[model samples]
Target chain A: GAGVSQSPRYKVAKRGQDVALRCDPISGHVSLFWYQQALGQGPEFLTYFQNEAQLDKSGLPSDRFFAERPEGSVSTLKIQRTQQEDSAVYLCASSFRTGRDGYTFGSGTRLTVV
Target chain B: AQRVTQPEKLLSVFKGAPVELKCNYSYSGSPELFWYVQYSRQRLQLLLRHISRESIKGFTADLNKGETSFHLKKPFAQEEDSAMYYCARSAGGYNKLIFGAGTRLAVHP
Candidate 1:
């Protein structure tokens, strides 16, 4: 892809239903990050992957939230037993170098849990 | 804890008028500050970072350590500048960025 690509631009889930969102970062980008953005609020960090290793998951709201970047190029954000609070825009971003502000963001997956 | 603050939720300005969007932060150690913007139905993109002192699209922001402020300023505002702006901060060694609540700027022609 020319840029970061996120799947299922909009998602509708029933409460307690599991859902998976996918993100394809820019080719060869070393750093990948996931963020959650509520209405009228800025994006909040959820997890970060420096390659195939998930270095940071401290921002995950709960144990139900899980993310993985097994091969380092494509990543998945899985939410088990989805709750109403999980409704938000899940954003994916990739950067060429670590600790740098140069990042490109995807269109984001707007998840709506009913 | 590191936090970024964008006091105004919305700001309106006339074309060719000066525009300044205030940003403040609170972090224990040295922090890197950044500004991101999003236009209508578009993805968020980085505008600039404090690490680079150069201006972009006629906008420039300087990091003031003592005051813990990174205010973005432009001498002349254009209607094309209307968008939502966000302030972000990250502590050294941590690649995670904490963003502020964001401000929506409206430049009228």
Candidate 2:
């Protein structure tokens, strides 16, 4: 794809429900990242992947937040037992190398936990 | 330990007025800073990086290591420039970015 792509632009989940968001990064991009943006706040790093290797997961807020990039091209972010506090927009970004190359961001998935 | 702070939640200015968005970061080591902008209903995108020292859309940011600041500035604001701006710092071998709360710029005509 010419740009990073995210699926299910908006989602509404009930409390305790599990939801999964998807991201398709630019072709052959070597690094992918996941971020969460709460209302009125900047995007916060959730996890990072160098190719298919999950090199960092330090920013994931809790164990309920899990992200995987099995093939390094596409990634998935899964939230288990969603809570009201989980409502936010989830963004996916990919870079050609690392931070020096800058990043292309997806439109993001706005999840509303009701 | 890596933190970015954008003190202003909103900044309003008339078109053609000068604009400056303040940003500050706290990191012991040398940091890579960037300014990202988001137009209404648009995805966030990079505006400029301290390393690049380039201006985009008439906006420029200079990193001040002594004060730990990277402030975005424009000579004349444009109506189309109204958007949300974020200041970010790369950390952990440039693997991740820590972002500030963001500042909303309203360039009115």
Q: Comparing chain B with the reference, what is the TM-score for each candidate? A: 0.95, 0.97
Give lDDT tens digits, candidate 1, residues B1-109. 6788999999999999999999999956887889999999999999999898879999999999999999999999999999999999875465678899999999998
**Candidate 1, DockQ to 2 decimals?**
0.78
Clashing pairs in 2: none
Residue by residue across A16-108, what tens digits does model 1's lDDT show? Answer: 999999999999999999999999999999999999999899999999999999999999999999999999999999988785856899999
Each model's TM-score? 0.97, 0.98
- For each candidate, the alpha-carbon lDDT, in order, equals 0.93, 0.93
Error of 2 at B56 (Å): 1.1
Candidate 2 achieves a global lDDT of 0.93
Q: After superposition, how far is residue B2 of candidate 2 from its true place, in Å?
A: 1.3
After the best TM-score superposition of candidate 1, give how far the Cα of residue B83 lies from its true spot, in angstroms.
0.3
Tens digits of per-residue lDDT, candidate 2, A10-82, equal 9999999999999999998899999999999999999999999999998898999999989778999999999
Using TM-score, give the best candidate's number.
2
